[model samples]
Target: MIYNFEDLKEIVKSKVSIKRFNHIMAVVDMSIKLAKIYNADIEKCKIAALLHDICKEMNKEEMKKICKNNFSEDLTDEDLENDEILHPFVGAYWVEKNLKIEDIEILNAIKNHTLGNKNMTLVEKIVYIADAVEITRNYPGVEEIRNLVFKDLNEGILFEAGKKEKYLESIGKKSHKNSYAMQKSIREEIKKKN
Candidate 1:
């Protein structure tokens, strides 16, 4: 079904975990603004924002278990490693199998919100950008990127990913070796007009 505000609210009520729901709401608000500005699919943006982290609390082991049972075999090893990166793919599966959502756009947005795919659609970019810049977020330089999101999406995307990479380095986390997909995505987006 096409999701509007009330429908989103209902879905949130039914599907959201208590601790994460507030974050979801924050993303939803930001996503709506982005959808308006970017002329994206509003319902898909809302649904994707609402469901982006549906499996976030799952640990790597749990994620693996779920993926083993539910995931298609076409996923590569990098995709498996990145399973712990974000839960949007698992979330999409849950949202479909449990929540009865069947829209391909919504599923794609949820699937791609993290470590975004190359040549992302408007809906995918809307959710990814919105999730990064939501008000509940307090990462360094978020306000700068938040401002840039309205003015120059590609710049904001590059800046945010760069910021995240730096933050990971600072926290002594291993930075992901630049995946070929990310390189391709960066190159594709670099060519786009704001």
Candidate 2:
């Protein structure tokens, strides 16, 4: 039950691997910056970023128990089968149940950070994009996406989604349905702009 900022850091440090901790720190820094740029609630953004991957390293059996205990429409049985893709949902529920956080926006940001949603809020977008473009992330085109985010958030979102889809397809893996839905929504929004 990490209630405060310090407690959050301490818990994350103790639980996650060193590499994951560094990535979490990077997300915290980047989420704060993006929160300011996008006029989001910085507190919520920080909370979301800090706990976004709370279950990332958990074994599938452990994560499955958490989901079964707290499962809802937001986290269905089907979602539990794919812990790799549905970790965000577990993280979100864990935050709410364990940390006693009742902020829907923060919970939603955590829940949808990985796959995204149809109409994402600024905070949600910030968390999702921050997790990808944080300084520690060094995949190809990350710098380009980082720069794009500062200039045009929606374009950055589209680029990230497109990149993710392409990578998944290249590996013969189908992206979560939510990702495809969000991509469609982003494309539609981009179409409206052009």
Candidate 3:
């Protein structure tokens, strides 16, 4: 079944809490802004941003069940155990299986939004950074990271990845392998630019 943007918005609203819905909206707005600036596909950004966290509110068992049922081969043991990282995988599957979204870019953006991979497309990067630095995110240094994203997308990603790594380490959580890969890839991209 084909779904329009508004259809997607309403569906997401009903699935997640009001607070999560608001965050999704903020990410959508931020994604559009970044997409315009970066020459990425705006529609893809909006769709990806809206669906990135679709499974975030789901219980761990539900998310794990989806993961086990659909793409168990693709997930690591660590991913199954980590709720923060697991939702993206389940979300990607949910959108593909339930919503009939065939676009690999959108699926990948949703899958990678939580722990970005080694090679992120423009839409992927835009959605990832937008989710992190959206308007409602009021963590320390967020404004600076937001500004840096507008200045240089790769730099913004690098900084955000660093901050995420540090935070994960502080909490005694091991950073996902994809996160490390993303940082390495972004650093190389930045080097190529300079």
Best by lDDT: 3
lDDT of 2 by residue, 3-110 (tens): 588888887787789999889989999999998888888988998899899878878888888777765655657777888766887788777888788888889899
Give the per-residue lDDT digits (tens) of candidate 3, residues 1-194. Answer: 24499999999998999999999999999999999999999999999999999989999998988888876766787678878878999999899999989899999999999889988999999999999999999998899899999999999989988888888889998777888889998888878878
- Which digits, one per residue and each the tens of the lDDT, describe model 1 over residues 99-171? 7889877887787676666667788878888988999899779999999999877677777877877776898
Specify the highest-TM-score model's number. 3
Model 1 quality (TM-score): 0.80
- Predicted structure 2, TM vs. truth: 0.89
* TM-score on alpha carbons, each prediction: 0.80, 0.89, 0.94
Q: Identify the runs in model 2 with alpha carbons over 4 angstroms from their true place.
A: 1-3, 68-81, 188-194
Cα lDDT computed for each candidate against the true fold: 0.75, 0.85, 0.90
TM-score-sorted candidate list, best first: 3, 2, 1
Model 1: lDDT of residue 128: 84
The predicted structure with the larger TM-score, 1 or 2, is 2
